[model samples]
Every structure is written in C-alpha cells, then in structure tokens.
Target: MVEAVFQILRAGKSLELIMSSYELLNEIEKRFPRIYVSESSGNGSPELVVIEEAWLPFMVSLDVMSSEKETNRRKLRGLFDPNGFHELITGLAEMAYKTNSQRLDTKVCVFIPLSLTLQPASKTTLLQFLGNMLLFQYLVNVLEGDFLARISMYKESMNWNFLRECLINMLLASKRVNYRVLMKECLHTICGLYQDYAGIRNEPDSSDEHSSENHNTDVAIALLEVQRTTCMAMQKLIIMIMEIDMSKQQANMLGLTTRSDGLRIPLIEIILDELTYYRKILPRFLQIFNDPKWKLEIIVQYLLKYTAKPVRTRRSNGPSEDSTFLGVLKSFSDSSSAYMSLTSQQQLPGMPGCNEAVIDSLSLVEISKNVAAAFNSLREADKKIQISSLGKEALFTATMIISTS
Candidate 1:
C-alpha cells in the first residue's frame, strides 16, 4: 500500500490523480494507525497495542521529484487544497508525536519544495510552504494543553492560521531539549530558502530589453521588493509581540533554557547576520532608488529601535546632544586615553541619551537650512558609518520636544 502511494505521488500530475493518491493514503492510515487493534490474542479478546512507526518511510519518499528533472515527477500542489492538506498534516503530526519517530521532521519538512531552497522563489511557493509548516506546527501544539486554546483562537488566513504565532511557537517548542536539534534544522533550512530568494533578487538581471545601467536600477527595484516582503513580515511579528499581554502563567514563556523568550523574539542574531550580508550587498542595491532620502530614512528608522525605553528629555542649559556627538567621537578616535572613560561613563562626553531638537513655536520641523547644514557636517565626518545622524537627532529632538510641551 505504501509503495502504491509513493508511486502514485511520484507520477501524479492531474488533480484527479493526486486526490486519488491522497484518498489511498487516508484509507491506509485509517486501517493501520500508530496504535491499532490487533487480531484476537487466542482468548477471543482483541489486542490493542502500540506499534513501531511504520508510516515514516513512505512519507520520506513522498518527494516532488524522485530524481532531478524527472519528467513525470510533480508536486502535490493540486491536491494541497485547504482541507486536504490540513488533514494530511494533522495525520502526520499525530503519528509522529505518538511514536516519537526519529527523523520525523525530515519527513515533514520535505513537504516544502526543493525549489524553495533554490533561487528566485515565487510568492505562491513561499506562502504555501509557510502554510504547510504552520499546519504541522498547529497539530503538534494542539496536543499541549497549555497552548491548545491560544492555538485555536488564532484565525486562519490563506488556509493557514496565525503564521507569526505558529512559527514562533514551533521554534519555542523546538527549544525544548528533546526536539531542539530537529527544530533548529528545520528553521535553518527555511532561512536558507529565504536567503537564496533574497540573494537572487539582489543580483542584476542581464536583460536584452534594458541597457546595463538601466538593469542596475531594475535590480535595485527588485531588491527593494524583496526587502519589503521580509521587513513587512518582521513588522507583523513585532506587532504580535506588542499585542501579547502575558500578565500571568507559572512562566510567561520566559523559561529555564534562556532568559530570552524564544516565543516573543526570534533568533535576531541569525536574522541580523543575514541582514549584514544584505547590508554588504545594499550599496549596489541602493544605486537607483527613486527617493534616495526616503530609502535612507526608512533604513535608519528600523535600526534605531535599539533604545529599550524611550525617555523624554528635560531642558539642558548646555549644548545639545547632536552637536556634541561628533566631538565625543573625534576625541575617542584621536585619544586612546579616553576609551575607558568614554565607555565607563553613563553618558558619553558630549552626547546625551536624548538628542537635541530644534523646533518651531508650533512644534513643526521648520529648521530645514540649519538641519541640512548640520546633516552635511555629520555626513562628511561620519565616513565610518558608525551612527545615523537622522536617527540620533530624531530620538533626541522628539523626546525633548515632547518634554518641553
């Protein structure tokens, strides 16, 4: 029966063929589950007993392609309608969770296409792949009494429910000692897919229709699109973080493994390291944006979120933080003697935690000329790109302006 399922899946192309194969597997699963009634134990009583994981080997072989570029091999895409895929994943999750099967993730992760791991991922594939993983994660989480209701409350979109929540939940669950490595591998694989997708978008396409210079602009636009997708997803997750009012629990996801709540925050270093690679490629990617100022401003806005608690600044009789920041940097650079003093002090020499703001009586940004001049000075001296002038100034100015009012 398993051999028949694999053969049908490998050769299946039409929706009818795929659904037939799905039905076959469903029937087989029904007949011989992880725990099933056995023949009578000679005393006319039926035996109900646990069995070895007999389903995993067939699932592992349910590849879209048995070999590379196999003409007959195709994805189960047509069969992956909302209800059908959900049923399939739920079955697999239940079976694997029950038997505690080894390499079960490998079996499940194969549901994501091998093409996703390649370059130039389509939006269709990405969402479908994400949907499938979340489905599997939901099934597993459903068994945990703690997560059951929250998992149920998360509404489904695109036939996949709260992706941000599910992804984080799965990662948090994986952090457990038993499932850690398997879960990590699955995450690393998914990240690798996106990296490939992003990497492909960052490159200039050699198009016959466009000149070489124009092609660079095209690549920049494409890179921006890819960046937007990732950044939007991140923003959604951040909003989800803010929404979580975890006022109670024996522990509100801040557990023994690490002080960091894996559920609340993603592996940021992993993400940032990938972004650093994106940053290295960004200079080329930024060559031909229509609104260069807005591009620079947006990037600065994202990176400026380092301030843990935003504080309003009281009036200072002395020079503003923005004006003094460069002096502090200069002194720190020219004098190795100030290194310890600079870092040790709660405040840096000339710069305050809150920066300086120049505002109108009406509290409007009416200091364009002065601001531009200051910006130029900062830009010229900030060759190392150690800090963003706009970010620092905005932080300082906004806080102070609010305080003064």
Candidate 2:
C-alpha cells in the first residue's frame, strides 16, 4: 500500500492524486516510524529500537541493488537505491544547470523516458520534471525523519551505532555512489533551482501557446511550489549530512568507531574543495548553506587557506597559529615587509617560481577587499543570516583594513 501511494505520487498523473498520495505517505511515516525509542524498565533510560523489518524508502545494500528480483521490485515500486538517487540528483542538476544557462525551452520538449504516457511531448516533459521534484522532496522527507529519530536516540544513548546505520549515512557510504560528485551535484541543484524559481516568481509570464492550457498552468503552479520546497530540501540534506559528519567525528574521538565502519571524507572538506575549484558558485553556496556555525567555519577556513603561512611539519594536525579569522584580518594591517615575510614562503599551486608574484597579486589589500566582498555577498544572499560576535569583529576588522588599504 505504501509502495502504491509512492508510485501514484511519482506518476504525477493528477495534481489531486499527487497531493493526496504525498500527504498519505507522510502521514503513514508519522504514525508508524521505522526508528524510535522505548522506555527501559531497569534504569529509566530510553532504549533505541530500530524496526529492522520495517519498510524503508531506500535500498542501501549491494546485494539488494544487485538482485534481479529486488531490482524488478524496485522498478515496480519506485524505490530509490543509491544509484537511482544519484541519477535523480544528476538529472535535477542537469535540468537546473540548463535553466541557469537560459537554455531550457518549455516549447521544445526534452523527454525523459518514464512509464507515464502522457500526451503532448511538452506536457509530458513538464509532468516528468514535476514528478522528479516530488520524488526528491519525498526522499528528503524520509531521510529527515529517519535522521532526526536516530540523532535523538544518539543524544540520549551516546551510541554511535544508531547514527552509523542511518539511511543518509548508509546511502552516502555505498560504494555505488560518488560521494563528492553527489554533493557537488546537490550543491549545483540547490543554487540553480534557487535562482531559477526566484526568477520565475519575480518575472511576468510571457504568453505562449502552452499558457492557454489550464492543465499546464496548474502543473506550472504546482511545479513552482514543489521546486521551491525541493531547493529547501536539498539544502536540508546537505546540512544534515554535515551534521552526521560532525557526529561521526565526535564518535571517532570517543573511540566508538571501528575499521569495519569504513572511512568517508568529511562533507565540509568536499564542499570547500568544490567551492575552491568553482569559485563562481561560492557565493551561492555560502548563501544557501546558511547554518551559522558551519557557515562561519567554512568562511574562516576558506580565508585561512590563502592567508596563513604553510606548516613545516606533517606531524602537526591543528590549524596554524595565525589561522584564526581575526588573525588573518589583522595580518592585512601589518607592514608590507612583515606581511611579505609571513606569506612569501608559501607557493600557489602550479606556480613554483612565482611566490613573490603570487603574494604581490594576492596582497593584503586585495585579500581584505575580497573578504569584505564575501561578507557582502553573504548578507546579500541571506538578509537574516546571524553574524556571531566573532563574525562581526572579523567583518569590522576586514572593512577597517580595507578602508586603510
């Protein structure tokens, strides 16, 4: 019955049916959670109880993904395995990228092969897009529910096992998924959809042949709402994964993790790597990934990577002594001779002999200017993003140095 409703929602044949099925699935999840806590009789503590046999929206294991019968069942039931989820996110990312490039044409139907045989290629394309959006939203909803339950249990029990077995963790841990690519695609999808939907809402509709169809209009209206929610869901998923990484690190520090658990690179590192390579998306990503703690950390780390002096020893695991945001900003106010001595030894990648040129180009003034620009971008991205006292001090210091420079 759950699978049937999921299929109906994925089919997206009727908006009414889509809403009803979507709501029904959510209600079902709420009433019958797969993970919860039961009060213990002995110590008055809450015991985590995972219903192993309970139905899940994901198929994370390799055996289940490999089996012919299981594969056929997934196809029939619209279940999302890791590979399928990756494909879904990839598709959304591509669609969003195209839209961002202003190459998405509603008049020309780009058909995605699906079971639904809706008439008119354009309508079919729209419906397929809507279906994918709805599907992603539902999956995020499931992940959120499961994660919240597990994290709650972990808080009470301090048991890393419960979180390690979470659906989001398992989904990302699967060998079939490229964790970095998945995160990059997710970042792209969030930024693209955010811009695309905002433009759609702000711009006036240009009348076209398709605009006359009330059915198409209705789908467009629904699509707008779903896409907005989908953008939020993408952000939520990224933030949740970051939360999981933090929790995992905590567990590792406590010696609760094992080798069998395998190693996954922290999501923050991946995000930082992506932003460094694709600086064009940095502002958008910072704007969207608006968790105050992580956001400040990312910004500080990003600045430190360029400004801080290189470490001489591989044994040192901590950040450089001068890596703090305030220190980096203060470095901008130092004498040119002192600043040059501080950063002249560091070499930019692919430019071994140009350390002086690199330092000259990326001068303290230039760094301070960019720092102020980044803060402005953050404020522009989110008017309500809370700047911590440290953040305010850093910003003030950057702007003051910039003015002096």
Candidate 3:
C-alpha cells in the first residue's frame, strides 16, 4: 500500500485522489488493515493477509491522493493551493498541541521539513507567533533537550553550514524579540567557542596542524565577523530605541508620562559597560572603533548626549539626586586630566580634538552650575538630588587615574 502511494505521489496524481487518501487514513485506526495473510498452502483455505500500514498515514500526511501524477500536479499547480505547505505546518502544530507534546516526532518532523517554509511577514499574527516560537528561550529549551544531541550529529556529519545558519537564525530571532539577556548569553557562547578554538590551536604537540590552524584562524575569523555584525546591529537597534526614549522624555518634561523600559538602562550605559567588560583588552574595541564603517563619530555624539545633566525625578528627596549628573561630570573631568596635562605640542589621531569636544560637548564649569541650579530648583520631589550635592566636592580633587600601559 505504501509502495502504491509512493508511486502515485511520484507520478503526480489528481487532487481528488489525494483528498480521498487523506480521508481514508483519518478513518483508519492505529493498526493497519492487512490485504492477505497466507498460511501453510496444503490444507488451509487462503487467508487474507494484513500488514501495518505506515505509508498510508505518511502519504496522507503528505496530502497526496491520486494515482494519476499529472492530474495531481495540475491540481497542486499554484503556490496558493489549498493544501499548501502552510496547512501542513498548521496541521502539525495542531497535532502536537493536542497530543501535549513539544517535540515533533522524528517522522512527523521529517515529513514537514522546516526548510520548506517561509519566514512570516511583518505586522502579521503569524509573524508574531513564529517570532515567539523561535525566540532564544525557545531555542535554549531545544538545546537543553534531545535536540542538542541531534544537532551534534549534524555538526559531526560536517554540516557546519547548516549549524551556522541555525545559529544565525537564533541570533536574528533574539534581536527581533528584544531578548537582551538571551542575546548576551548567545554572544558569550560564540566568544567562548572562539576562545576554545584558539586554545586548541595554541596547544603543544598537536599533530593535526591543518585542522588546528583552520579552526583557530578561519573559524575564529568567521565567528568574530558575525559577532561584530551582531554587535553593530544591536547598537543601531538601541540607538533607534534611544531616540524613542528621548522623545518620551521630552514629552514627560512637558508633563506627560512615557512608559518605556528604555529608561531602565540607557544605551550609553550599556556600551560603557560593554567597553569596561573588555577594558584590559582595550586594543580590540579600539580597533573596532577605528574601523572605517562603524561611524565612531556618530556614536561619540550619542555618548556626549548621555553626558547631559541628569534630571532630578520629582520624587527625589535629597541633594544626592540633584548632583547625579555633576558626579558623572566630575568623573569625566578627572579622566580628562591626562589630556589637560599633555601639552599642545603633543600630536595624536583624535587626541587633540578630544579636549575641544569635551569642552564644547559639556564644560566642567557648566556642569557645576547645573548642579547648583538643580539644588536651588529642588522641591520636595527632588530631595534625593539635593542630598547628592556633596558629590560636588569631588571636583576640587580631580586627577587622572592613568595606567602606564
């Protein structure tokens, strides 16, 4: 029966045949109906034999019905055919949900290959559903389950491209969903993988020279390229989100409430944290900053914006809150002492301009004035800022904490 169904499917039979096959399978129980069962030939009457029919359901699942291949092909001519690939996904999802199963059975998953589907389009329910389904958390769940072992088989079989593509998909999904924590974890994993590859290359007495070199150089380069691109993508996303956050603040300044999580962690603060994370390897990030395509100047503009006076919340109760931005300014001034100490005779790329940028961007004197003004302006709502005013004393003792390196 399975052979017959396969023959029909290969032959490209009619739609009616396919529908009938599907309906018939739906009516059948788990056990297959045997056609003929024969025993010893001499004495017993001919017995009907029945075999378990895997193909009936499988073919039906494929939605192939007819023996006439041409008719079926004609019936399924268009991409929008009623029994299109999407319906298969819909059916699979439904079955999986009904069965209380998260893992698609191997046979069922094979029947509906993920590669055959299209990514859902923007602003659509399907897109949202697909995005949620393929989020980093979801992939992490898959990784922690049986899928990890199966994924290893693909890698072991030298299917690195597919694995890489899958990883890329996971990264993109993370960005689309704004799953920051998960995205960071994935980035860390990629970095760890690169470091491990490098360590293997640096190992002593390794015989597989070509493999070690390839792993350390080629694989590491590819990984770094992806990581850089992903980081830039995240930066751009954050910038756009920051713009929205800025607009909200402007509105709020005019007495409107803006509900945004962007305020929870400013983009500049995040970048600063990222930079600090690898401060010991400053050369790497500095190299990245020097890259021609990164638009470091534009990034510098945003960083300057973050240096603006920190506005005191209406709920603040002390001087400390009022001087928050001043404290930051003090820190900046302290750092800039290295620049101040250097003579005009010193020449370096971007260094000469740094002093002017800092002065024009947000002068130390102006920041100090803002701190004083903030305190005078403070009402009961800004008591925190008032309390933080003692931070102003740090300015008088400013000095650079320079490293000889």
Candidate 4:
C-alpha cells in the first residue's frame, strides 16, 4: 500500500492527483489497516489487534508525502509550502498514535529531504537545515511538558526553512500570504538555536566540529536573520520586554533585555557576546545598517544597557569581564560613517520612524540622576564626600541646555 502511494505521488503533477492519492490511502486503511478481528473466549467477538510495525515509518511517510507535492519537496521560487509540512507532521503524529508507538521512527526520519526547494545553495537554507535538526531534537526529547509551552518557540527552528521558503513564495505569490506570524515563528527558532549552541559552550576555550569563524559568521548569520526577522515582526516581542511591567517569566524569553528580578540575567550576557561578534563583523553590520530602518535604537538600547549593569569580571586571574561597556560604546562612537549614512538614508521603508523619540524617552538620562542618588546614599554612610567625576561636566552642560530650552 505504501509503495503504491509513493508511485502515485511521483506520477502525479496536479492538485487533483494529490487529492486522489490521499483518498486512496484513506480507503486502503479502512479496509485492511494490516489488522484482523479474532473471536475469543469472552465478550462476543474479541478484537485482536494485529499491529503491523514493520516498515511503519516508510508507510506513514508515504501516506503523507504522496498526498501533497509541496509537502515533501521544495518549490521553485525558494519558498516552502507550509501546508505540505503540516500534512507530513500531522500524518506522522496520527500514524504514531494509531500504531501505539511511543516515538516517531527512523523511517519517518529518512523521508526528510536533503535539500528543500527554496533558494538552492543559499546560506539561508543552510541555517534553516541546522535549525530544523536541533529543533526536532528539542521537541521530540527535551522540555516535553509545561516547560515546553514556555519554549513553544523551540519548534520554530524547524520551520525557519519553511518560513524562508514562504517568504520567497509570497514575493512571487499571485495572492500574498501575510508572513508576519511566519517571520515571528522563524525568529523564535533562531533564538532557540542561539540558546542551544550558546548553552553547549560554557567557556571560550571549548573546541568543536566547526571553526569559530564558521559558527559565528556562517551559523550566526542564519540566527541573525531570525533576529532581523524579529525586528521585522514590528518589534512586538522587543517592546514587550522593554516594558517595565514585564513579568519574570516574560523577561527570560526576551533574551536581550535586562532582568532585575534574577540573581543574574542571561540575556545581557547573550547580548554582550552577540555585540562582541558584531564588532568582529563591523563591516557587515555597517552594510545591514545601510539597508534601511534597521532600528538603530534597539542596537543603541542594547549598547546603553551595559553602561548601567556592567558585567563584573570574575577574578581568578581568570576570565575578565573586560569592561565590555567601553567596547560597545566605542563601536557606536566609531561608526560615525554608518551613523551619518543612517541619518541621511530615506529611513528605509519597512521600519517606522520616531524611534529617536523612543530612545530619548529611555533611562539613558536617568544614569546621571542615579549618580546624584548614589552620592546622597553614600555621603552620610562614610561621613565624607566621595568625589568622583568624569562625564559630570558634560552632564552639567546638557542640563543647562535642557533647563534653558
């Protein structure tokens, strides 16, 4: 039956053929199902379940893939048909339940294509492939409970390929499919990949199958797209994290924001590391900045964050925190050309303006105010005036201008 399904799928080219194949499979399963009813000692006719587990994976895959051309193969325009994927996964899950198997089998795994149809040989596809494998591992194994929903986005790593394909498809689509939700799904996947890979390496000294350049430049680029996509998703998640009222659980998911509730914030460390990478690929980032309204404010927000809660280097004559605040600040200050380009560019289409207003509205000004508060808190404790000044003169000048205005 499975072989028949596969043969028919390969032969068919149109929507009708695909529909027919699925109908055939449904009919076959109803009649045979590779089982039998046997009479027993009790209760009328005892139903003896003869479960045919052999080549189960192949059969299940055939049942799904045969019904939909887009399900198993990549489309021409470099986007994926997500409905195809939906059918495939749904078929696998249904088959697993019917067969009473605890987990999906390798045969089901074997049908997963080597290359998806979208954007042949592009770097985007490479990352999507990696995202899919890692996401599958997490979904089928780790975080299989309530914690799973917390990381519901973990499933997205697999779908990045699909979303990329979908994006391409929409561009050529006769009628476009809104990909905002799809983009968000892909970004979630990318974040998950970053969390996984970043989690695996605890120290800078660790070695792996891929070179650091490959991981950072190649793999990281893919994840970065996910980050970029999130920005495209209208910064919905980003805005949520920035909200002062954000709950502890929500803060954890928005990995780049500062978390006051935790003993330590993981997101800040992640941003620091990401910024370090950005510094390495400064030229590339400069290029992205040139593309459009890349939301320089989000980048600026991240840069300014370290100024407030600078990472304290763990001493051991060991790993030094290295005052990354200065590093980030310097990067921003150094990018005079990029900033000028940004200021002059026509505010690239997708991103809305007024981000400048948002940045001005943030706590950047409060840093100096905090200094006064800190000074007052310490003045009485020590019974001595602790005098330290650096940016104070600049702040004073700025205050004067503000007061006059």
Query: Which stretches in model 1 have alpha-carbon errors above 4 Å?
Result: 1-174, 177-371, 382-405
lDDT of 3 by residue, 72-94 (tens): 65445321122332232243233
Error of 2 at 250 (Å): 2.4
Candidate 4: Cα lDDT at 341: 26
Off by over 4 Å in 4: 1-169, 172-178, 203-405
Error of 2 at 99 (Å): 2.5
TM-score of each: 0.28, 0.74, 0.25, 0.22
Tens-digit lDDT track for model 1 on 1-405? 565564554355443454465456546655655444445668764444444546332112222224644322333322222233334434323322222111111111112233334443343433333333333332222223222223333321121222222333433333222333332333233344344444445455434444333413332333334333433333333223222322111134333223333333333222323434445433332332224433433333223222112233675455532322333322333323233322342321211221223221222333333343443444454444454574577546755654565
Candidate 3 Cα errors over 4 Å, as ranges: 1-228, 259-263, 289-405
User: On TM-score, who's better, 2 or 3?
Assistant: 2
**Over 4 Å off, model 2:** 62-67, 100-121, 205-215, 310-321, 332-405
lDDT of 3 at 339: 29
Per-model lDDT: 0.34, 0.71, 0.33, 0.33
Residue 45 CA displacement from its true place in model 4, Å: 85
lDDT tens per residue, model 2, 224-299: 6777888889988988998898888889989999986788887777776777778888867766666776676677
For model 3 the local lDDT of residue 199 reads: 36
User: Which pairs of residues collide in model 4?
Assistant: 71-84, 74-117, 78-118, 78-119, 79-165, 80-165, 157-189
| Candidate with best TM-score | 2
Candidate 1 lDDT score relative to the true structure: 0.34
